[model samples]
Target: MPYSYEPHYFEDLDVGQTFESAGRTVTETDFAMHSMFTGDWTELHTNKEYSEDGPFGARIAQGPMTFILSTGLFQRTGIVERTVVAFLGMNYMDIPNPVFIGDTVSADFEVTEKRDLDSRDDAGLVVIDSEMTNQDGESVFAGDMKFLFKLKSDAE
Candidate 1:
């Protein structure tokens, strides 16, 4: 059986098409959960005393946690909800600032490139430039996300 749904096809996306997701505040539970899940309990992220003496002057959220949150934020936009086939890769991922507990965060994305996949009639590729920012509009993370998208023309 085949799936039936309309999706943003390769032809529908433009280089400048942009999307933004709702904000979420980073929480202590988020840090605890992420730490238990990944065993990444570095003092910079978990121990207040250790971090107070560290560079950021406070315990900060893990870098990967911000990445995961950003991805979740982008997914909430429904831009690729049903059209995505696979996550191809990410490029130039950089975390320029720290995400502290209780800080509100949101994700912003723009379609930067799209190309037909000659090998796949039903799908194409899209590259999205993404950034995750805090309440102050300072970026905590930025990167390019590549994904395989089901083309609308081929879904029917």
Candidate 2:
């Protein structure tokens, strides 16, 4: 049967459609947990004294953590939950601003492109322009992500 609720099938999304996910504070706990999980205990992300003397003037969240949080925020939006078949890849990933503890960040996304898949008629590709921004509107991370989404007919 077709999906009973609204879910973004491949054909349901349109280029230029934009969405912003809810904001979440990046706490010290979040930073620490991410560090432990990834074994990325870089001074910029973990050592306050070291970072205080460094470029950002204080410790900052890990880039990968920031990216993960941004994606999680967007996932919480529930727009593509069950409809997405796979994450194809990412391009042009960049971190232009530091994300510090206590900073509130939100995920923003825009549908930039959509195309059919010749090998698999049941799915299509969707290219999304994604970003994470702090409360001050400085971008924390930005990238273009490609997703394979099941066609509407497959929802049944």
Candidate 3:
């Protein structure tokens, strides 16, 4: 089934089309779980009361938590199931608004650039601008990511 539903080749990608996913609500478990992994023990993120007295007036997801969630949300698209060679990295990331616990979040993408790597005939580079938004349509995070994908020729 994975092979049957292989990802599109670089040439097959639609630059202007957006990719999106169902929203996932941030939860206390999400915060605690990620905090353990990242060592982000900020009171503003871990304590609801402490957060309520702070700027956003509620406990919010950590910036890195938002980043990780956004990536996980986007992965539900399974774009890499067929041809992804590697996840390059992210750039120009900003967590503009707080993402509070119970806030539902979703992610979408726009293709920013695509280019065939001269050094690799079987692979190419793809750049995407991704944004994570809350239920109210407020953007909580945004960034650019690059991917190296195996071309159809390489799949053979």
Candidate 4:
């Protein structure tokens, strides 16, 4: 069965609600583009020869790149496109494994908490526990993401 793509408002979300995104393969172009955009030319990420001698034995994606990719995967689910007001922040970001080129990855998210904003009738706060895993099932990134979401009553 196909996973239903449902539009969600702040009022529609509840603690323990979970979502998983489709996989995307990390590519050389992703590395190069990220490097060029961020001016992060670290040897381990940009130099294959240098990376070959490093602990991981090959070039690895930058930590921030993995986070970016995870966010992209989350957005691909289309759950937050129209309801999100702002990204409040992230906490406990941990990269437990390296993301190598050609490795496929996906993101999983679960609502951890929700709070109505006393000062803002239009929005509420939500914290989501996020994890990104590789094809091998090793976690490449994990964190708690907080966002401000528009309430259903206020979205009209």
Candidate 5:
């Protein structure tokens, strides 16, 4: 069934409520593409033989790759389908664990703050505490992201 994208009001997102998104598996090509794009040929990610000597004992995806995958997973969450105005920026981004090829990744989010944009009557701002976890359910990345979106008509 086709789903109608409901416009979520800024005030409707409760502070403790959680939102999750679909997961994705990292692949060899993903590593290659990222390496090629950034010219990051660090053996830990691009050289299988060299990586074998590392803790993972195999070529692991670059930490930034996990960060990128996390963004894709975050987008799959329908939260952005609502009254999103714009993505402002991110803060405290960190990767605490190594993400390897074939490992799946997903995103979890909690609304941290919401405030009215005094100058813009139609929208407000929201800050979400976001975390990206690997298939093992370990938090690999975390940060806060800010967005601008339409305000709820009934919001105080």
Candidate 6:
């Protein structure tokens, strides 16, 4: 789905509430730019000719790039928008499949839990389960992400 543009406050999210994001095609630019930005020119990801003889038979995108694209697609869905306070952390991250260039990708997000902050009534903590897939519906990335969010009363 495309962007829905809702600023989700702490109270607005519920466990099991799910969201889907629009697709974005992974490109050579993505691989190259990520390689340039991170200085990760691992032969399997950067040297196509060398990768031709290696596993997967082609250069694959960086695992970090998959995470980046997945998160970017999630934000494109507009769920956080101006509602998010800060990203706390992630848990159990796994990259189960290779993300090749030209593969369109999207994210499926589910709110798994919510917790009240002991020090603040204006903010809360939330956990979301995320799965990223390619056009072929193969799992590329999966994780639980934690975030700090403003409560409804604290949202403007």
Clash pairs, candidate 2, are none
Question: Which of candidates 1 and 2 reaches a greater TM-score?
Answer: 2
Please identify which of the two predictions, 5 or 6, would achieve the higher lDDT against the true structure.
6
Ranking by lDDT: 4, 6, 1, 2, 3, 5
Error of 4 at 79 (Å): 0.8
Better of 3 and 4 by TM-score: 4
Q: TM-score of each candidate?
A: 0.91, 0.92, 0.89, 0.95, 0.80, 0.94
- Candidate 3 global TM-score: 0.89
Displacement of residue 115 (Cα, Å) in model 6 is: 1.2
User: How high is the CA lDDT of each candidate model?
Assistant: 0.86, 0.85, 0.81, 0.89, 0.77, 0.88
Give me the runs in candidate 1 sitting further than 4 Å from their true place: 1-7
Model 6: how far is 2 from its true place, Å?
Answer: 6.9
Looking at model 2, residue 77 earns an lDDT score of 66
Where model 5 places Cα greater than 4 Å from the true spot, the runs are 1-11, 152-156
Q: Which ten residues in a row have the lowest lDDT in candidate 2?
A: 1-10
Per-residue lDDT over 4-39 for candidate 3, one digit per residue giving the tens place of the 0 to 100 score: 223566766656756776678888899899889889
When sorted by TM-score, best at the front, the candidate numbers are: 4, 6, 2, 1, 3, 5
How many clashes (backbone N, Cα, C below 3 Å) per candidate? Answer: 0, 0, 0, 0, 0, 0
RMSD of 6: 1.4
lDDT tens per residue, model 2, 12-65 = 889998877878888889988998999999888899999999988999887788
lDDT tens digits, residues 65-137, model 6?
A: 8888878877877878888888888978899999988899988999999999998878899998999999889
Q: Poorest 10 consecutive residues of model 1 by lDDT?
A: 1-10
